[model samples]
Target: MKVGFATQDLKRVDAHFGWAKNIAVYEVTPEGHSFVEAFVFAGDLQEDGNEDKLQPKLDAIKDCAILYVAAIGGSGAARVVAQNIHPMKVNQPEEISGLLDKLQDVLKGSPPPWLRKVMGKGQERKFEFEEEV
Candidate 1:
């Protein structure tokens, strides 16, 4: 699954969803993770209630299964959830690589129900039925 990190330095999930200057994306699997791409933003990125700043960021992470951020506004979180993306808020700044590692570890184990749901999004569902003999 794909994961997004809101960062200013691109090395940590240390920025708010609306104020982040860089949004880095990575492909994370139980085996490992790899960097996919990044979205860079410029100009004013303050908490001024400007909803327009969110569209590009949302579009950037549209395919991501989860997003890690230091903080996110209520509206931003709502929008993210509406898009079927899980937004995770960190109490403090965290290393992006470390977060990825933890996610990989969780994938190797039995992820929680919410995580499983997020991971299963866009995947084909299989069902088996028995015919009367």
Candidate 2:
């Protein structure tokens, strides 16, 4: 199966999926439960309010079975669902290893409603960041 993680710096899971400059996709083999191969999408930063920014990520979703993201907007979420790819909302953790561990279960199937609701809201992280500091 294939999985995609929305990330920034191509390493850490970023706070927001839309704000991620890149996405790392992995091909996981059921045999050993390991990532057999990987790919990266590196390109222009998504422009705020620019709907076109999601095209690449949407395109990437076509090849992956599941997508793990920090946060995603309503339209993006809808697009992902329409593409038949399961979307899993993952909180940005301090370590990627820990985050991956937590996601292991979620990757098994569809995400719960709470997560769906959050993604449907399309709330941008910039607002949350402003509230934090």
Candidate 3:
């Protein structure tokens, strides 16, 4: 599946979803992953609360299954979700390659339901949570 990452230095996932000047896309599978390409944001990176700044990004990652962002506005997340792309917010800045490896580990192991969904396990998963009867 394709994964999109928001990064500023082209190495770490430290860029905000709406202000990411450089977005790196990677193709990840159980075998491993590879760099696809970088999507440059030509618009103003300082602009905030504007969907126009994020449109190109959404378009660029239309085929992506997951998007890793340092931060995302509610509207931006909604847009991504509408496009069937799962959005993940990174708590801290980390190396993109390292994060990818972690995802690989999850893929190789017994991934949780959410991870499975992100990996495109199946459409419309049935969620079951234990509750007080």
Candidate 4:
């Protein structure tokens, strides 16, 4: 399975997805993962409003099973989801290594609370837990 990560600098994963300055795309194989190939392109998709600029990067990630991002706007989030690739939000670790370590846990078919709420619609209010004494 291939996995993509959006990082500010190709070197590390900071707290915020920071800026989209670079994207580190990795192709994971059964034997092991390949070296993370860095895509050095401008990350100014928001101001530019040019989705076309991202087409190539998105194409390179077409085969990826998941796209890990530190932060993504609603539109970009929707774009990734439309591609049928699972989007996982990471807390922006200090190191980029060992990122895939949590893949199994992340892919265990449990949606996050916010996602569940969104999917539940009004029913989400019914599932709210009461404060414990």
Candidate with the greatest lDDT versus the true structure? 1
Q: Residues 12-121, candidate 1: write the lDDT tens digits.
A: 99999999999999999999999999999998999578999999999999999999999999999999999999999999999999999999999999999999999987
* C-alpha lDDT of candidate 2 relative to the true structure: 0.63
Tens digits of per-residue lDDT for model 3, 17-41:
8888888999898779999999887
lDDT per residue as tens, model 2, 26-114: 65432223443343545555567777878867876576666777888888888887876778786543345455555555545575775
Give the candidates in order of TM-score, highest first: 1, 3, 2, 4
Better of 1 and 2 by TM-score: 1
TM-scores for all candidates? 0.94, 0.62, 0.86, 0.61
Tens digit per residue, CA lDDT, model 4, 1-133: 5667777666565412224666677755433456557766564645546667667667766666666777666766677777766777766454456765444344345757644433332232555788999
* Candidate 1 clashing pairs, residues 3+ apart or interchain: none
Candidate 1's C-alpha runs over 4 A off are 130-133
Candidate 1 has its poorest 10 consecutive residues by lDDT at 119-128
Which regions of candidate 4 deviate over 4 angstroms?
15-19, 29-31, 43-50, 104-133
TM-score of 2: 0.62
Write down the TM-score for model 1: 0.94
